[model samples]
Target: MEKGIKAFQCVEWVSKRKVPHTIDIVDPDPSWPTTFTQLATGIRAALPATVIHAVHHVGSTCVPGLAAKPVIDIDLIVADPADEASYVSALEAAGYHFLFREPPWYEHRLFALYAPPVFVNLHVYGPGELDLESARHRLLCDWLRKCPADRDLYARVKRESSERAKANGEGVGEYTEYKGATIREILARAAADAAAAGQGREETVEAGRAETAEAGTGIE
Candidate 1:
């Protein structure tokens, strides 16, 4: 499904929990995609077919050979993220804990699974609600997967960011912020490449606008 363009907004977390945590960057695992597939299958089974619009494996973990934080990031496109009652309970039942919601930011909802099987960040967005952020996520993943140079560059930035965050006693948010500049640089290249190929112009424009507003906000 195609998403329309929208302005970026940094909405405060509905249920904010400010906690210091370790930012552990690990080598790429071959099993990450398999894990995402398993999780996606489970999510599909847990929710009604009519409720789910699309399921995507996004974030750094989706990029092969890219060093990441060992947490799987999944984008779950639904009919309406604001209508939580339709899908939240089922996700909770499936062992994903409801973390928070950002109604102003594309009606985004976040769910997490921090337990045994595997850790996952399940991001929910409504159709036409994920304009820029969604486009950026997909572009980044595809670019990194095919472009080894950018993939390596991102890996180095991630490691540096993790080290700096750890040294300063910062959490995931700060760590993510540290990598913003490099992320934008990489995305710009990806967008340029797409434009040259005469494809994904809409996605490139939307994603570029998103980076201009807030680079690396939703990345990883």
Candidate 2:
């Protein structure tokens, strides 16, 4: 089932939706993809083939050259997000314990489970119900991959956030959200830049099509 998943669909989701946070700007671990591959395999084995569209490593940890919290943020694109009960039942059968569900924020249902300190955060997003979080996350990672200066700036914000989290002894949500807000601004800028580039590409393609049509008409 994992082998049947769509790679471009992952790209499309990132391009379309607005995600929560952007990339982490620091040295990356070469083993990130290796970790994700292992996770995806396990998820594929657990999830029912009918409901799981694709399981992705969509958070900062997935992106290379980013400093993440060492937690894997996996998105299980289910057929229906509201069918949390179905997933709850099925996953529990597969040894995953349901932890927290936050519906107010984009109707996104969160689940958690511990496997010997390899803590995983699972965000279940239903089909056609995407909010701002996913796309925002993709843009942040994309921008950092292309622009080193912005990435450096992001790393500093993240480090400062880490310090605050340490000094104040804050929880994961608080630390994540505060630092995330800063990255969101950068995501917005990257989004605008991307929109402009997309428009330019479309215009060029349209112009070529028009020329082709004119030449065809002349043949008649």
Candidate 3:
């Protein structure tokens, strides 16, 4: 099948389902890391050798002790994300469903897995496309894992945002907006820390990006 057609089918399939946005955060699950490892193993086995540039455990769940919705956000860095023909079929065969194709967003393609025991947002990015966001993801996870103060602040903000969204009868959009400003502030601080250490600053995560929330409700 053509990629465009497959993407359309995926969208239609999602529309027919009743997936809902997460309304609350939970304590960091000890099993999340293992889940990510298993998912990455499956993905690695499915891709061609040349396409497996890197696999990353990103998003809120990656940071130990950080409260998050129970979903794994993974970045599968490939040599050419635009070359869907080479990888998509194999991914499908491995039980991942291609739910999104965003050429404008650094040529990102998203796959989703909704089987028992695991839920994952598999994001594929080409070389240099996610350099900034990728750096932000890694550093933020590292910083939060080591710095208790920042981690507490982030968790508090997340709780407040969840409350606001629930009260406002809004979905992920409201939750994301209420959380974005705080996240940016944290990222700025992280960048400053990097600069002071003479490690240089990572670029903002939103630059040259196009993200869609319709794929699923998890905040990845």
Could you give candidate 1's per-residue lDDT for residues 148-200 as a string of tens digits?
99999989988999999889978887887888788888888888777777766
Candidate 2: Cα lDDT at 220 = 4
Each model's lDDT comes to 0.75, 0.54, 0.68
Name the runs in model 2 displaced over 4 angstroms.
1-27, 199-220
Ordered by lDDT, highest first, the candidates read 1, 3, 2
Query: What's the TM-score of every candidate structure?
Result: 0.87, 0.70, 0.81
Separate clash counts for every candidate: 0, 10, 0
Tens-digit lDDT string for candidate 3 (1-220) = 1223322233322222124536477888988998899888888888888988899898788888899877788878888887988898999899777876656545667777776444777877776744444555666676678778988998998889988999989876677778776676676666566666666343443321222221222344
RMSD of 2: 14.1
Two-way lDDT contest, 2 vs 3, winner: 3
Off by over 4 Å in 3: 1-18, 200-219
lDDT of 2 at 157: 73
Q: Give the TM-score of candidate 1.
A: 0.87
